[model samples]
Target: MAFAVSGYEGGKTVDFRRLAHTGIRLVGITRSYRDGVLSFEEGLAKNVADGDQAYFDVLREADAYIEENGLPFPPEPGAWELLPDPDCLTNPILSLDLAAAGITTIIWATGFKFDFGWLKVNAFDEKGDPFHKRGISAESGIYFLGLPNLVNRASSFIYGVWHDAKYIADHIVLQEGYMSYAKP
Candidate 1:
């Protein structure tokens, strides 16, 4: 959604792909369309979470049928501008005069947060993302194999999960590391 709103422009760590419906400013073609869409959704989740912006990316795109009827999702918050300083309150903009400021509108991006309350391990960070290296989370022998890019872009796909599962099984056959963490 951010990418779409940015008209495919990138940020410090972000990269954009052009949308045909949006405009012709930029275009990103990928070898696999499905993968690209999946990656976009994943990046959307991450970016919204990282920015601590209101997450209504569920409105990233309206269903064709729905759009035809005209549903107004609250407009997305501003193209959230990050300040040079980390203290968000210090630089709050108390007022803006549209004519004097040459501004058109204000959109407030409400941030999103993930909940890991059901997980058995103490692995999530302050932001609720599990701490991981490769596919391995902080909890010994526990793997977040189902997450996107646990080790690579394909990590959460069927093939990737199968490959990772096989590797885990092989390791279990040769060593008892996973068993050590398994309840006896």
Candidate 2:
């Protein structure tokens, strides 16, 4: 199948044909319609473990939705290919060596629990989350970024991170009285 990623204005307008809702919560994993108003399978309210069955269930639902809505399929046709081993999804062995691959940075985005112990800062709450006001902590020279609702609802989104970063940067520059140097 052909695939393309495009951007659109975000609001009430949702292109359900191109999207599916899937999430992993503390309760369990959930895969459903984006609006959650529709269910392809009966009794989909309960969470299930992430596995091949759940993955296929979602694909089947999406296929049904597309067919039911008379949405056009990709022009190209190809047989669906399954991964050789499902275990690779969880424990993927890297084929590329970072040093040989000339990789400088790796963003460890494990989407799991947060561990702030290495921060060595006392600016955290009892729950261990950083205690900050729009990324600015009580302790000077320390800041946070890309956290949910850090400044607004979009704080964690890619489209919103720059605003948060700029806010923090401006705060740092102003607080350090660097504006005097820029006056020329």
Candidate 3:
């Protein structure tokens, strides 16, 4: 009875219809947005331009259903009203609180980029920007899936993530030489 939907305007709007047609009752939907600046439509447009047609279609459908049924966009009660703190430091704690309040899981579909500025580790490229070599981050357990130049010029694309993911998986299993390894 559980149905997963991404947070985006066009694709989610479309996917919701398919779910409704399949007789799956809409219990809830999670909103994945950074800083609440980009709307669902904006996210979908970015995905479409990036050639993520599959994701774009899925989100378009789901959002349509929500609008048709007069259901709230996020579907989760109080989600829209909750404004994140300006400092952004409250995010993790707020997420934990939400989980304790009955949210079983969080689907974070947001795109990625370097956020290492906050970390004390001096992990960056020659230009002082965070460098993701082979999708491995300087921080342990933190890996970058889609980043340009990881394998090739277009390694940030979806197909490239698969190849990069393999290397990450292998490194995790064979942690002897991996820099991310640490003593328990």
Candidate 4:
């Protein structure tokens, strides 16, 4: 998804392989849609393959984040402790699970599932739909255009992206210094 946007805006073709190089990982999760929503859990328990060391080398870029991010280096083998918060707890399983999963970032290319639960904003209304003023969001680089009555009633339709795409693409071009979002 990022590659697609970057390519369209940059006027240069990019590949998904860049995802791994950029400290992002992907896993396809099994899911079913019902009533215009997608639902899945990380605990669904499926086989997610791990990448080679070459791919994981991208994580070294985050090494400086160990102390600042509070994700310290892995404890010595067979060493384990759990801290409870305010009592702060450290479960080695958390890191071990991530390492075993080989997933630094998982991008699900599912469309229109309207599942932004991972977003850290209170962008939802009482009914859980995006509470944006029109399609704009308070969160940086985030916007919601295709939802019922988002901008206008038609903003959720196929034509919505046509209108909003230009805005988003223009923003991407400016922010990322890409050429254009025009389709070749």
By summed lDDT, which 10 consecutive residues of candidate 1 come out lowest?
33-42
- Best lDDT goes to which candidate? 2
lDDT of 3 by residue, 1-184 (tens): 1122334563342343343346532322233435432122223223222433444443566677888898866654331231222222211122224433465564665345466567566457776576667777677766666666577534666645788888899987777555555655
For each candidate, the alpha-carbon lDDT, in order, equals: 0.45, 0.55, 0.49, 0.45
Quote each prediction's TM-score: 0.34, 0.42, 0.30, 0.29
Candidate 2 stretches greater than 4 Å from native: 1-110, 178-184
- What RMSD does each model have against the real structure? 18.1, 15.7, 16.5, 19.6
Candidate 1 per-residue lDDT, tens place, 63-177, comes to: 4445777876544344344323322122323333445645456343533444678886878777778887655565766666666556643466575677666666675565575
Ranking by TM-score: 2, 1, 3, 4
Better of 1 and 2 by lDDT: 2
- Evaluate residue 61 in candidate 4 and report its C-alpha lDDT on the 0 to 100 scale: 40
lDDT of 2 by residue, 1-184 (tens): 1121126554322222222222221111223324322123322222222233444454677688888999998622222333232232333232334455465675545245568899887789998999999999998788999887688645877888899999999999888797577786
- Backbone collision tally, model 2: 0
**Candidate 2 clashing pairs, residues 3+ apart or interchain:** none
lDDT of candidate 2 at residue 21, scale 0 to 100: 27
Q: Per-residue lDDT for 65 in model 4?
A: 66
